[model samples]
Target: MKLSAHVEKVPLIHPFHITGYTFTHNDLLVVKLQDGTHVGVGEALGVYYKHDTPYTMLEQVEALRPTLEHGITRKELLELLPPGGARHAIDAALWDLEAKQRDMPVWQLAGMEPPRPLLTTFTLGADEPEVMATEARGFEGVRAIKLKLTDDALNAERVRAVRAACPDAWMMIDANQGFTRETLASVLPAFVEARVAVVEQPFPVGKEDWLDGLDCPIPIALDESIQDHRDLGLAVGRAQVINIKLDKCGGLTEALILAHKAQEMGFKLMVGNMGGSSWSMAPGFVIGSLCTVVDLDGPIYLSADRTPAVSYHDGHIWCPETVWGGPVAA
Candidate 1:
């Protein structure tokens, strides 16, 4: 087997605004593993928020090439690479390769019931109220909306504007750890007022204890706070949900573990992404089967994406065989 990677910069259809900055493009790490005539593909987006870049992923992959080139399985690959973009790209490609090799679909390989169409949440990035509302209005079949938030007074105004524009759409919000303890208390009423279903990681990481003593009007979902199993114990009775990203939790190997652990603790589950094409979204689609909310809209944001884009119709996304390596019954 031969291991290789390349980066592709795919521009977003519009500016993606967050608390402190705007992202115009996604830097994707595309990986390929070839053995003779068969080749498998995978993708990952270097997330700046996590200090992951194309260069950093490349460095890590290069150091592990000796191992990957010598016939590595997806399970072994997880042990070799740390949980992040690089491992995610490699792990996903291996799953694709294995499915092709076995002449069976990924869902079958995992012993999962075939995937039905999935209802995914559309995200409204943190921005000026009116602009965010305008953007929200343009999308069709968006039953659920996840609004981005900041630690500012205007947070309520933004939520209100989006709610007004999307009155029938269910709402959730992610602060991406932008809030302080004081600000969180102040915004709790607004979140409840807006009827926001889940408030995600409002405060910074490692502040899990702050959430333990207080009562929130809305349930909190852990994103940055729940990276691995080590953090799951502290999350007991602390958070109501855990947002599991395959990349953030290393890959499906650990993500599956984290999901079950969070479930045993009675926390709702949400499966999210790092933003990329269908190639990147496929792995998370498996995890979404067990989640309350799915955010696999990464490919939809791109101006162009890999062929056979995941079919998201009427707010429901269906993963296709061309992208997944084998046909699956719905």
Candidate 2:
């Protein structure tokens, strides 16, 4: 087998601002693995928050070239690298390569049911209340909307504006670890009143224990707080849901394990993304089959998508038949 990677800086349709930072373009690391005539592809967005960059991923992949060339298995890859963007890219590529070799979809290889079109939540980045409201109005027919909030004074105002504009839409809030304890306490009631279904990572990562005895009307979903299976125990009594991102947890293998573990511990599951084109979102879509809330809208944020892109319509994303994991056509 042979491995190679390159970074593609694709522009976003708009400046995407969350709680911590803004993205004008997504710097994606595209990894390719080849065995004779067959080629497999994977994508990763090594964002600064995770301390991953395309160069870092490339170095990691290059370091493991010997093992990869000697033909490493998915399980072995998990131990070969720690969880993050680098492992995610190689793991996804291995899955793709295996699927191509077997002439089947990756879901089948993973013993999962066939992928189905799932309703996904579109995101409204942190912005002015009116700006968020306008964006919400544009997605009037979307079934669910995920609002990005911050520790700003107008956090409630932004939620209210979106709720008013799309009164019937199911709303979820992602603070991206922006709120302080005091702010979180103050915002809880407003969130419940606005009919927000879930509040994600309101408190910073290290402050997860703060939720231990606090009464939160709406469920809190942890993103940064929960990385792998080890963190599941820490969130048991605190958060009701865990947002699983393939990039954060490394790859689909660990994600599957974490999802099952989270389920066993009586927690609802959500599958999110790190923002890229369809190549980046394909794996998340496969994992979305087992999740309660699916937020695989990364491709929708891009100015353009990869060829044979995953199909999305009416707020639902269809599994790609042309690439990655899905049942092959007869």
User: Would you estimate the TM-scores of all the predictions?
Assistant: 0.95, 0.97
Q: State which candidate has the highest TM-score.
A: 2
lDDT of each: 0.82, 0.86
Q: Poorest 10 consecutive residues of model 1 by lDDT?
A: 321-330
After superposition, candidate 2 runs with Cα above 4 Å error: 326-330
Please, what are the lDDT tens digits per residue for candidate 2 over residues 1-330? 998888888999899888879889888888888988667788988646868887898889888888888898889988889888888999888888878777888888888998889989999999999999998888735889999998789998998999999888889999999987789888777888899999898888788878878777888899988888888987978988999998889999899999999999999999999898898899998889999999988887788898888877887888675857543345
TM-score of the candidate numbered 1? 0.95
Candidate 1, 85-116: lDDT as tens digits: 88877887777777777678777777777887
Number of residue pairs clashing in candidate 2, backbone atoms closer than 3 angstroms, sequence gap of 3 or more or interchain: 0
User: Residue-pair clashes per candidate, as listed?
Assistant: 1, 0
Quote the RMSD, in angstroms, for model 1. Answer: 2.0
